[model samples]
Target: MDLETVMQELEALGKERMKKMYISNGAHEPLFGVATGAMKPFSKIIKKNQPLADELYATGNYDAMYFAGVIADPMAMTEEDFERWMDGAYFYMLSDYVVAVTLAETDIAQAVADKWIASGEELKMSAGWSCYCWLLGSRKDSEFSASKLSNMLDQVANTIHHSPERTKSAMNNFIYTVGISYLPLHEKAFETAKAVGPVEMKREKKKSSILLASENIQKELDRGRLGFKRKYVRC
Candidate 1:
């Protein structure tokens, strides 16, 4: 469908509760607050439409931007295009979930993510780390370099506590992802998580979240999910 029709459908699916939640999570006006699941049927209908996705993302509506990620053709996008998208991502949900998730599907995923990780911008760093988490959780362990991953785990152990709140959360998740999904560095990731200990992620109004990657990794291990890799990164 077209952008207008899609926006209308998304607006029709909007809910007050979800809108409030999005606002609380840093979304601004012009959003319809449609649930991500609610957009699935239309996503199937629209499939991957780079042009339409660009139009929707440019709208600056939270739900529309999210839907843009759902319909975006990652393989067709350039690093410049992804950089443009990253420029529009204003919050953790958009950066880490939408932009990073879409980037994880591309061949340039690691290259671009590396640049973003080194960007030193809060959301960019968060998205870069989160992109790694998505990649490790879905792609085969053989696709990654064990030494690089080991160094990343060391980086998390050394710097996560002092990183930005969102970056810390993503870094903690990176440790857990390496522990559970990337078998080559599981032991190293475990050691890193233990050394990192609990990470405090401060929120605007909510209580700070205590993120313990070691504990989360142990929980997954308890469930016999060690070395687990998902078939897909996005739903």
Candidate 2:
């Protein structure tokens, strides 16, 4: 489908209830409030349309950008494309989940992740951390850097308290991904989680919640989902 058709479909599917939810979760204006799941069919239809994905993202509408990630051809994307997306990404949905997951499957994933993590911007840093987590989660034990990941685990344990809210949440998710996807570090990550304590996240307006890393890890372990690597991070 074309970009205009996609936007029209998104607008048709948008709901005021979803708009309030996205806003509460830090989404900006120009959003159609289309639910993530609602974008799937459209994504599948336009999955190979790189130009369409680019056009959708360029529109700067949150829902369209969200959909762009769903349809974007990560392997075909240039570093410039990734850079533009990162620069325009202003919220966690676009930065941390959409762009991060899309890039995590690419050849330059690690390079892009390292560069973004070094950024002073909260959105960039969070996206960087999230990209790293997803890449790590999808790799085999032989390809992963245990020592480096462990060191990052230690960093989160030490500095998550002082990191930006989004960065802290990404770090917490990183730790969880590490524990759940890397058996060698599962125990160590559990220890790090206990040491780091609670990960506090700001929800809509005045609401907030704490995610207990240790508890989440334990639950995954009990469910026998530990060390299960995903084939892809998208969706």
Candidate 3:
């Protein structure tokens, strides 16, 4: 679908509703306010909208503004342009679409590396969380991603006891989804498992191992499950 249609379908308001739902009732206690899911396939209608995202971020609609960076392929943008977009990417963007977008087959991985450095918010920093994994996977001479790779890795490592339970579960789901596509990302996902503090991650089976999970909450979103969204939403 076209960017316009995608925007129309995945409107920030819709995401806001989901975000609110997760925060209010869905997210785990540790992850109560953190995001763990992706822009549902239904949300992918937005093909591209870096310009509009700039406008929103400029206007302080941070949620939507950050999403622009998440959806846009970093390669499609100019170096300077990407630097600017990364500047507006809200720190929390990583909790949702940003991580998936960054690790996805976007052209801006290098530019993202540059921008990741520009914004230096320490403590449970999302940029580093995924960037470290990406760096561990592949690199353009290990310069671009490796450039700021160490710093972000430190940010993620330094972050202890940051995520909650529900957030961890959702992250597990999302990471598994990301892994299904790229084997390398699977190893990178382990970074998240490690970042999740020992005390916080109660289950011995790592969060990245979804197959080993309880499978209760995922059934809510799983279409194959008897009580899918249709049945569960009604009840």
> In candidate 2, how many Å is residue 222 off?
1.4
TM per candidate:
0.99, 0.94, 0.41
State the C-alpha lDDT per candidate. Answer: 0.93, 0.86, 0.40
Per-residue alpha-carbon lDDT of candidate 1 for residues 1-235, written as tens digits (9 for 90 to 100): 8888998999999999999999999999989889999999989998999999999999999999999999999999999999999999999999999999999999999999999999999999999999999999999888998888888888888888899999999999999999999987888889888888888999998999999999999999999999788887889
Clash number for every model?
0, 0, 8
Model 3, span 120-187: residue lDDT tens: 44312344334433433343332333324334334434433455443343334434332232333333
**Segments in model 2 whose C-alpha atoms lie over 4 Å from true places:** 202-204
Residue 72 in model 2: lDDT:
83
Ranked by lDDT, the better of candidates 2 and 3 is: 2
Question: Considering every candidate listed, which one attains the maximal lDDT?
Answer: 1
Candidate 2, TM-score vs. the true structure?
Answer: 0.94
Task: Answer with 1 or 3, whichever has the higher TM-score.
Answer: 1
- Badly placed stretches (over 4 Å) of model 3 are 1-19, 22-46, 56-59, 66-71, 94-96, 103-120, 123-125, 134-235
**Sort order, lDDT high to low:** 1, 2, 3
| Residue 118's lDDT in candidate 3 | 43
